[model samples]
Target: MIASSWLLVAFPALGALILLVGGRRTDAWGHLLGCATVIASFGYAVAMFVSSSLAEATDVALYSWIPVDALQVEFGLRIDPLSMTFVLLITGVGALIHVYSIGYMADDAGRRRFFGYLNLFVASMLVLVLGNSFVTLYLGWEGVGLASYLLIGWYTGRPSAATAAKKAFLMNRVGDVGLALAIFLMFSEIGSTSYAAVFAGIGDLSPAVITAIALLLLLGACGKSGQFPLQAWLPDAMEGPTPVSALIHAATMVTAGVYLVARAAPIYNLTETGRLLVTIVGAFTLLLGAIIGCAYDDIKKVLAYSTVSQIGYMMLAVGLGPFGYALGIMHLLTHGFFKAGLFLGAGSVMHGMNDEVDMRKFGGLYKRMPITFATFGLGYLALIGFPFLSGFYSKDAIIEAAFGSEGWQGWVFGGAAMLGAGITGFYMTRLVLMTFFGKERWRELKSADGREFHPHESPPVMTVPMIVLAVGSVGAGFFFALGDRLVEFLAPSVGALSEAEHTALPHALIPWLTVGLSLFGALVAWLIFGRRDVPVERPQNVSPVTRAARNDLYGNALNEALVATPGLWTTRFAVYLDNKGVDGAVNGLAAALGGSSGRLRRLQTGFVRSYALSMLGGSFLIVAALLMVRFS
Candidate 1:
């Protein structure tokens, strides 16, 4: 079974091809095929994990991928702890999302096409994780971008969805440029793009060269993972189906950055400055997302911002070098379980509430949606790092690791991470109270289309996946952290866990202090939202901080001021140069040639006397010059 590990990608790719090619003729059961394909991939992954010996990394070669002068690349799979870990995650969570989409998109006319895109996405992500070389990984990376664009813009009738998809594709392209250049640089410097060659050759290169490569790779990771400056696209991606949100934002695409940084641990291990930049970006982004999340009333957008914040934590973890690689993966795994559950739970609420996404219009829904409320509550608790929950085990470990860093770095990053946790608690608690605990605000309100609100539970197909993920949200941390099992298991791939010798804060007090801050944040939320009369219409007059948070802390405004405005003028200037400089020069030369030629053509008038006169004048001038020369 391990020998045929390539089939893991082939299965979903085949499903996507068949469904898409089959078109409306296969509409009746395309979704089933999609779900089955992912399930099969997941089952095969489990089989390989159980049967194979991956103590050292196992390379299964498919074929020679690129064969050029002194450059060689192979299309292959690396069966190891790191790749296998992502394989299980992509296929497992992907399979659930497929099943849930059956209920969510059941009534839509494009369900078949949606499932096809879903399969395509899963297959692409699988290829990304399984590939052993940078070029191969990039092939899958572009495939993911393509699939994501299709899925996000599925609702072609909606202008917002179309714009969001374009925004996502263009922003990701900026990062893709960085990744492609990194690969080209690797081939130039190391003469190979294979992981083994690149990692082994890093020792021979100068520190500056290695740092350059790492930073470029980090740029690509940030683009894909929704890190700062590239983050605005992700929240807007909520225009797609809720299941798309759960899969891309929660389980797969956002975590790709952490995986990249972790996989490149060898290079980062050699560069202190490179690692510090990553930590700084992660720390700032987490706070950015957390601050913005507290002000959103749109249920899905709030969850979208929450995803941005959590992925920030993961980035910060991986940015800590050897100390946080395994820890980052650990948080990533636990976050997958809980965050995916939260998004799905949000979908369930929307399903019952006629697709209304505002928390302002939602109130006391727990009575009508008991299963959704319970599951969402578990996910919420886990996200906020409630003690003994999955988040507690994974997140607190990251906090501990951050605080243990040397000198002022520890306090700055650690304080940022802890503060992010508190803000997460406050906003997520606010979301819960506004959506599930306050007075039934829907009683006095109507849905977007003037439809009456009659909230109820979602179908079992959707609820079941939510339930399983909720269980993970509750217990996955304990399982992964038990005996440090996950760390030891992942050691062979990322490297052995490194503990810092110095401490900015007592290591023992980290978890306690972290939990205390979260509780305080949650307490404030309860006081503000839970106990008050829930207002269906949000108030206009608010503090400056609240206003800033509501405006995404002016992230878009910053981008517009910095990138969009400059880019627009630069484009116009280029156009002007093309017209007045390049084209103008060419047109002037043409005009001059035409004028000179026209004047010369007048001498060729179709009259014998004119030709004779011109020839006689030329001959007389030549004769006079020759006579003068002879006389001299």
Candidate 2:
């Protein structure tokens, strides 16, 4: 089993290498290998999850990788409920996304490169989830960042893709700085960087230092998870392939932040101030993302903002401390299923329409593509936290935790989250109605230039993944029955933090009320847009404020001013100083010495006669002085 754990990660890497070496000439093999690798890995994850659930604790530790007098780190794999859950998420959702990409990138010229990067991403994510220590985790962390950079810039010829990649890389670096600082603090405080050592040392550290470390880790989480201020890159990340967006933005990479916080629950549990900061940041980001998502017109952009919002909810639950860990992890699992399905469904629509992404251009697509529309529509409902769906169970859990007897602050944050849910429902309905319920708006399809275009269903390869994910999106929540088992499984690694009591609110009432609120939101959208008999008004038809919101609320401009401008100015300033200040000083000193030598050059100008006379005069003066001294 220990060796098999390594194989789970190695398989995808092997697939990637094979595709890189052999798939350049034949993409069929590339897709086949990529799909097969993820499926096999997913099979292993499932087997582990079931076996670990049924049997006693199952962990496989390899030989020590880091050994010191005071500290030791081993290369090991844990099959606890936490790691098992994430493994399923990575491999199951990842496998479907890989399979879907086969159809999504069918006509692309660089399909081989695409699959290669995709396989690499899956492998790195596996490394991240499987690692037993911070050092092993960091290896996967940096690996994912590298893969993201490549995949984001897959369309290197497009300026937007390049720009988005650079933005993501730089923003993540800002967060990574904090992560690095936290690692240093951990090593200094505990004398080790292993997860076991750090958790074990939590009680020995000062509360202030603990808070600082947690906050630093939170900063890094914010960057990876697409929280506010650092979140601007995700929307623009749609510049990559649709499958890339589905996999990284929706399913896996962005969720790393939540995983990081959950894995380090012990550190945050030690400090009240740290918990407060996490809650505040999480709440703020949730509301901010929901607000921004309400105004986006692009299909993928809307989903991107939703990803940010969903992660915010996860952070909120995690911030509630050890008690919320189960909630956070549960949401992570369900979110993966639903969001990945939605993004892929959207990708299928794009594929059918020849890559049109604007919601305004589509209408009444249900008749044209029933499977795509039904799956996407259902996915939207799941995201709105409607009753009985996977999202409802997880999201309601967070809201319930927020409203517990802790303080009004939790209640306030929870209330705001509830409002965000309604807004989520409203905007999703607006998207669905605008794109699929009204009259067909793209008359160009009937025109001479558009005659060649015909709406068609995605191939079975794509639909199969969508169907599987949709099923999971609808049903994965029932796994929460194993919550206690989960806690026990992770206790050795994550340790115990004060467990939060489940909310006192009746569970039966919560889902119904939230769903009612969501329905009201959907009704508003239906009334405002769905019933329109003629072409809807343009964005300008709305108020200037609404127009601004539709334009990402000028978040892009603020990002340029706050992040881009300063970064460029600093870089340019450093370049100038190196060229003009430091180099110029050395060159200036040499020039000055040369000038002084030139000024004194006349004295040495080939004057042999003058030299001889001066020597004779000096000799006479010396002889006269000596004679005078003798006479005296």
Candidate 3:
């Protein structure tokens, strides 16, 4: 079964090929085929997980991909506990998203193309996780970037969608450069890009080299996972269809960063500076996401920011070195369940509300869409770390681990995690209240077409998946955390927790402190939103802080000032140089030659007498010059 692991990626790759090349011939049942492919992959993943021996990692080499003197790279798959975990999450959640898209895109003329892109995304992400070497993983990394661009711009008719796609592609490329450089360094120093070889030789590398490699990998991770400085593209990605949001932002694409860090634990463990940087990045990004999440009116954008924050937690967990690698991944799995459900539930809301996304305009929808409300409510609870929920088990563990660190690092990271939890509760509770609990703002206001608003439940095709994911959101943590099974399963890949001397926080206080802050956040949100009326019209007069958050805390501004403006100016300068310097030099020389040739053309007068006279004059001048020289 491990030897045939290539089938996992092949299933969806074939689906994409058929749906795309078959064209209109596949439109009738293309979506169903897409769903089937992912489900089949999920089934295979489950079978492999149950039957494969967990004690040893299996490497399946499909072929030698690149061979040169002293350099060999194989197209292979690594079947281990870590890769298997991601395989199940990707295919399982992906299958659900595919099913949800059937109803979500049923009316669109390009639904077949959409399904094809979804399959391509699944195949690409599978390759990223299963690849046994960095080179192979980079192949999948580029594939995912391409697939995301296509999916995000699915409605190419919308300028915003097209722009969003371009932004995501370009930003991801920036991080990709770091990953590429890191691989080059590996080959330069270690003479191979294969994971086995690289890990085996990691000890021979200097601390400086290891730190450089770790940081480069983190750069790539930040770009994919929507961490600080590269996070602006994520919320705008909401311009894509909600199903795309559910699949990419919630379950698979964004989590790739966490997977990258966890997979590179051998490198991270070697340098304290590298590990501390990861912690700092994670700590900063989680707060950044949580703060921004509080100011969004768009339901999907809110969830998008929430995703940024949740992934930050994962980053923070894995950044804790051995203590948090398994914990981070554990949260990632649980997050996949609830976050995907939340995004799908948002889709269901948009489906019934005539595709409205503003939470300000949504109110009293519980009665109209009970299934969506129930499923979304469960996911919301899980996201907020409600007692015994999946997040409760996973998120709280991370918080406890943060505090378990020795000194000020623990205090700082633990504080950030705690504050982020509270802000998460506040913003998510705000979303729930505005969208479902208040008076129907729809009844008072008209839609874009000036028609009265009508809300209803989505078809069973969509709601059923939401319900299924909701169950996972409620139960997956308990299952994974019961015996620390997730930790034990991942120990082989990440190594067991270290017994290094550190000042550990009191374990009893962490969970209570986290939950108490969360409740306080929820209370504040209810007081501000639930007790008061939410205005349907966008509020103009607001505090400066709210305005800043609405503007993404000047994130885009900073990018524009530091990156976009500089880039634009550099491009303009290059164009100027090309026109005035390069082109000018060529054209100037051509003009001079043309002008001189034109004057010289007079010497070629068609008149024979004139030509003879010119020749005689030239001969006389030459004779006179020779005579003068001889006389001298």
Candidate 4:
């Protein structure tokens, strides 16, 4: 199975091709087929992971992918600890999402086509994590981007969905440029893109070149992962179907950036500058997402921003280099379970409540939809680092790792991570309280869809997956963090963990401090939202801070001001130059020639009298010149 790991990608890719090509013919059972493909992939991944040697990487070369003069790249699979870990996550979580979508999307007219896109999404992500070379990874990278565009725009009739799809695609391209450049630099500097070769040859290059490569890779990571400025597209992506949000936010697209950074551990390990910049982006975006999440009435968008914030934690972890690489991957795994469950729970809520997403309108759901409430609540606990939950172990480890950093680096990054935890608790608690624990606001009136708000649980298909993920959310972190097993598992790929030589704070005290802050934040949320009768209508008048949080801290407006407006002016200027500089020169010369030729053309007017007069004048001039010469 390890030797034939290519089958993992093939199953889903083949399923996508069949479903897409079969078209309407597959409508009867296309979703089941999609689920089977991913489930098969997951089973195979589990087998390969269990069978394969964990100490060293295994290369399964398929064929020569690129055979240029100095560039010999093989299409191959790297069945290693790191890649296989992602493989299991993608296929396992992906398969569950597929099953959940069956119930989630059953009534939609485009269910068959949706299944096809889902298969494509799983296949592309498999290729991304399993690839042995940079070119192969890039192929998967672009495929994921394209598949996302298709999935996000599945509701083509909706103008908002189309706009969101375009936004995601275009914004991701900015980061793609960085990834492409990094690959080009790799090939130019090291003469190969194979992981083994690049890692081996990287040290031969200068520090400047290595740092450039690392930072460039980080830029691409930010794009795919929704860090910082690239973070805006993520929440807007919730305009797509809820299943798409769960898949993209939890198990697939957004996680790609964290995978990219973790995979490039060798490059990042050499450059403090690269790692420092990465940490800065992560710490800031974590807070930014948390802040924005607090003001959203929409449940899905709240989770979307939470995805942004959580990915920020992963980024912060991986940015710590050897000190936190395995910790990052651990958190990512645990986050996959809880976050995916949370999103699906949101979907279930929508399913029950006539497709409404506003938490302002959702209240006392726990009694109505016990299954969804139980699952979402557990997932929420995991997300907010509730004791004994998955997030508790993984997130606490990261905070401790942050505090281990020396000097101001420790406090700044540690402080950011700690503060982010508190904000995360506050906002997430606000979401849960408004959604499941408040007054029965939905009983007051009809929902947005003009239906009476009769909330119920999702069907067995969807609820089962939520339960499974919720289970993982509760316990996966303990298993992964136990004895540093995942760290040991990932050591061969990301390098062994290296503890900071010194610490700015007591290591044992850090977890206590983190839990204290998280609980305090939760307490504050209870005081503000839980103890009050929530209004159904959002308030117009608010404080500046509240307003700013509601507006995503003016991120979109800032983007318009800094990027869109300047880009628009630059484009207009280019058009103006093209019209005046290039076209004007060419057109002016053409006009000059046309004018000169018009005057000359006048002299050639066809007439017998004109020809005769010209001949007579010539004869007279010749005679006059001869006479004058003879006289002289």
Candidate 5:
């Protein structure tokens, strides 16, 4: 009966306020309050989705937020298919995380503050997705970044947490510069920042100007999405709680980039160069993250790398231009399910153990936590684009869209993504077998009984979400193919993307090829890492060349030399120049003038007799000179 549109955002924000103010005294109620709000929002999101699904285009404008003489910004809620889809994702998956956190953070001293931040993040993300215009969207953009900073540094005691938070904030600030400039450009050209107005103006702009604006927007997306040089922060961001990891990395924060690009599909379509840049960046990031993921031993760190890699896939779809939007969105939704499940399942394992995250320490956990193991196994399989799961449907579609292109670009991108998938399978298999199938590697680890809690299961709260997400991971893809109704509903909002076209391939070919590729990758992984005597450990005794990959190669070294070292040395050099060069010159000049004044002081001696003699001598000389002049 209630208006499901605004309620989706408003309730969570209200809950955040309650938790912020009263969480300290509420004990378990803090988490209860937070979880309740997300659940309520999720219900509203579902209602809104169902309602919008039936309607043409659902837009609810509250009032004009920012109005000038030339342009007006209306505060409104838009629940078209695109926003509805994301809204359901954010709230539905987000609620599960909130429930998971109640168990995950039960013993933490800052539990209240943690729930408060979590609720605030969800609220902000809703704002981001439901905004009717760019100005409204940016409020949520900045808000989520701020929440990420807070949650990433939740454990202020750890230096790594603080450092990661700083890196995220600063890197995002750099991207935001480009975003701000792009906004200004849009206003200058279109006279409005509304999605409707800017998109309409995009068709009229010169290709060169459109490319510039689109590239600037891409810069912002890259930072928010964690691509290329800006991606360093994501791996280190594991310093936060596991729920924080699930929420930020998997479900909410990182997906903002995909949303931005997809939303701006119209503007990006105006420039060919901009579209190509998107594809290139996406392909590179996908490979880069997968390669790095292969080297990590830490469970969460591997997942972190995997997140960066998966996001790269989404970016690649965006690069494919309007033709790739549905594929990108589909992948984004499936990704939320599987990735969040993976992070939560990992958290459950960590909970069972005494916060141990290294895969090297775990072995044969399948017998202990069957639900967690099963859910996570499905998640990994889904993420690797294994057939029948959600990721397979979405990933294959994108690749197919790539191959359906006019030139060799499709082959180039499809090949790269396929290779990345193979590596993805290899690492994930190593992760799974090492943690759940092998002999327990760490005998030093003992249970509370001083024996071993070798195969433990998480509580009901944690397992419930994992189960639900796992189901979603396996089933979400069908919604895209079967729900033309959904496509029609969202058509107007994302009308820009409908411009690009692709070769109509047999629908059967994509799933089959994706299944074949994924199976091949899995087989390779099984052959390499699934062996019983697999060298008794990982390939730690590799050649020097191979060792580089395991050590993150020279990535850290490059960062130090390129970014950190230069900044440090520049600061020291500037200090030296100030003290020894500029300051010294000023001091030297002052000393010389002082010394000259000291020498001149003798000429003004305080001797009355000497002063009178000099005066008489001067008078005699003057008279003699005057007489000579007169004679002449």
Candidate 6:
């Protein structure tokens, strides 16, 4: 099974190829193939997990990909506990999303293409996790980026979708540059890019070089994981289909960053500054996401921001060094379960409500869609750290780990994590209240097409997956958190957690504090939104803070001012230079040559008399020049 690890990626890749090449011919059953491919991959991944757990990390090289004089890169897969864990998440959740998409996209003419894209996304993410070398990872990294762009812009008719796709693509590219440079630096300094070679050689590299590499990797992680400075694209990505949202946010694209950081633990472990920077980025981003999530009316956008916050917790966890690497991955796994469930549940709601996304237009839907309501409610509970749920186990573990850090770092990061939990509870509760609990706003509202609103339950194809995922959302944390089994299983890759000598908060009190804050947030939201008379119209008057959040806290504005505007101006300047300087010089020289040739053309007037006159004139001038030189 370990030797057959290549099949995990091959299954989806083959499916994508068949679906894409077959085109409309495959439309009748293409989605089935897509779901089957991912399901098969999940089965194989489970088998590999069982097999790999009993053995050490195994490297299976398929072939020599790039074999230069000094650089030897192989198309290889690493079968280990860490990679196995991700394989399960990507394929397992990805399979569910594919199944859900069958119903979600049933009416669309391009359903076949959508499934093909989903298969491609799964294949790319599989390659990202399974690759044994950075170069191979990068190949899958770019593939994931390309697939995301395609999926996000799946509705080509929607301008917002197109813009969102481009934004996601361009922003990811910015971070990809960092990853690419880090790989180059590894090849130059370490003389190898293989995990084995790099990890072994990393010890000899200077601290500065290690820090530089770590930071670069973090930048790439941020872009993919929706972390700070590069997170603006994620909420906009809500313009994509909800299934795309579930796949990217929950199981595949965003988790790539967390995986990258965790995989590069050896490098990060070498530099205190690098690790601290990771912690700082995580803390800041979690708060940013939580705060922004509070103000969103678009249901999917709210979930999108929640994803940003959840991923931040993962980042913060791994940033704690060995103490939190496994913990970070644990949270990532649980988050995949609940967040994907939440998004799918959101999809079900949309399917019922004539595709209305604004929470303001949704109310008292719990009766119309009980399964979605229950599933989404469970996921919401898990997300807000409801006790004994998946999030409570993983998220609270991260908070505890944060507090375990010595000195002010612990207090700051722990506090931020705690605050984010509270805010998460507040916003997610608000979403639930607005969408499912209040008066039935749909009765008085109309859908975007100006049709009468009629809310109903989605078919079992969608709700079933939501139920399965909701079960995971409720229990995955408990299973993974039991006796620290996840931590021990991941110990070989992430390193063992050293016992803490001091903590800002007591271990026994951490969960209580987290749960208490979460309840507080939930209560506050219930008071403000659940019990109050919710309004349907967009308010003309609101707090400045609410307005700021609606504007994405001016994140896009800053990006435009800092990156896009400057880039546009620079491009315009380059065009001007090309036109006036480069083109002008070339055209001016051509004109001068043309003018001089025009006079010279008279000498070649296709007549012997004309040639003789020109020759005689030239000869006289030569004679005059010679005489003057002789006299001087």
- Compute the lDDT of residue 128 as modeled in candidate 4: 94
Worst 10 residues of 6 by lDDT: 497-506
Q: What are the per-residue Cα lDDT tens digits for candidate 1 across 1-632?
A: 76799999999999999999997888999999999999999999999999988788888899988777788788998888999999998999889889999999999998988999999999999888888988888988999899999988988999999999999999899888989898989899999888899999988999899889988998999899999978988999999999999999987888888888888888888898889888998999999999999999999999999989988888888888876888889999999999999999999999999999999999999999999999999999999999999999988888888887779988999999999999999999999999998799998887667998899999999999999999999999999999888888998988875443223335577888999999999999999998788778888899999999998999889988999899999999999999999999999999999999999887776999988888999999999999999999
Give residue 305's error in model 6 in angstroms: 0.5
> 2 or 4, which is superior by lDDT?
4
lDDT of 4 at 428: 93
lDDT for each residue of candidate 6 in 1-632, tens digit (9 for 90 to 100): 77777999999999999999997889999999999999999998887676555346789999999999999999999887898889999999999999999999999998888999999999999999999999999999999999999999999999999999999999999999999999999999999999999999999999999999999999999999989999999998988899999999998999999999999999998999989999999999999999999998999999999999899999999998877899899999999999999999999998988888989999999999999999999999999989999999999989998988889988999999999989998999999999999899889877667877789999999999999999999999999999888988888787876554223335668878999999999999999998787999888699999999888888889999999999999999999999999999999999999999999877666988977887899999999999999999
Q: Each model's TM-score? A: 0.95, 0.91, 0.97, 0.96, 0.89, 0.96
Summarize candidate 2's per-residue lDDT along 339-404 as a digit string, tens digits: 998999889888877787877777878889899987887788788887778888888767767766
Q: Worst ten-residue run, lDDT, model 2? A: 497-506
TM-score, ranked from best to worst: 3, 6, 4, 1, 2, 5
Candidate 4 off by > 4 Å: 447-449, 498-505, 588-604, 615-632
lDDT of model number 4:
0.91
| RMSD, one per candidate, in order | 2.2, 3.7, 1.5, 2.4, 3.9, 2.0
- Candidate 6: regions farther than 4 A off: 500-505, 600-632
Indicate the worst ten consecutive residues by lDDT in candidate 3.
Answer: 497-506
Of 2 and 5, which scores higher on TM-score?
A: 2
Query: Pairs clashing in candidate 6?
Result: none
Best by TM-score: 3
lDDT of 5 at 99: 95
Candidate 2 global Cα RMSD: 3.7
Model 6 alpha-carbon miss at residue 594, Å: 1.0
lDDT of 2 at 611: 74
Off by over 4 Å in 2: 21-28, 53-59, 63-73, 445-453, 479-500, 503-508, 533-538, 599-604, 610-632
Task: Give the local distance difference test score of model 6.
Answer: 0.92
Cα lDDT computed for each candidate against the true fold: 0.91, 0.80, 0.93, 0.91, 0.82, 0.92
> Residue 112 of model 2: what lDDT?
78
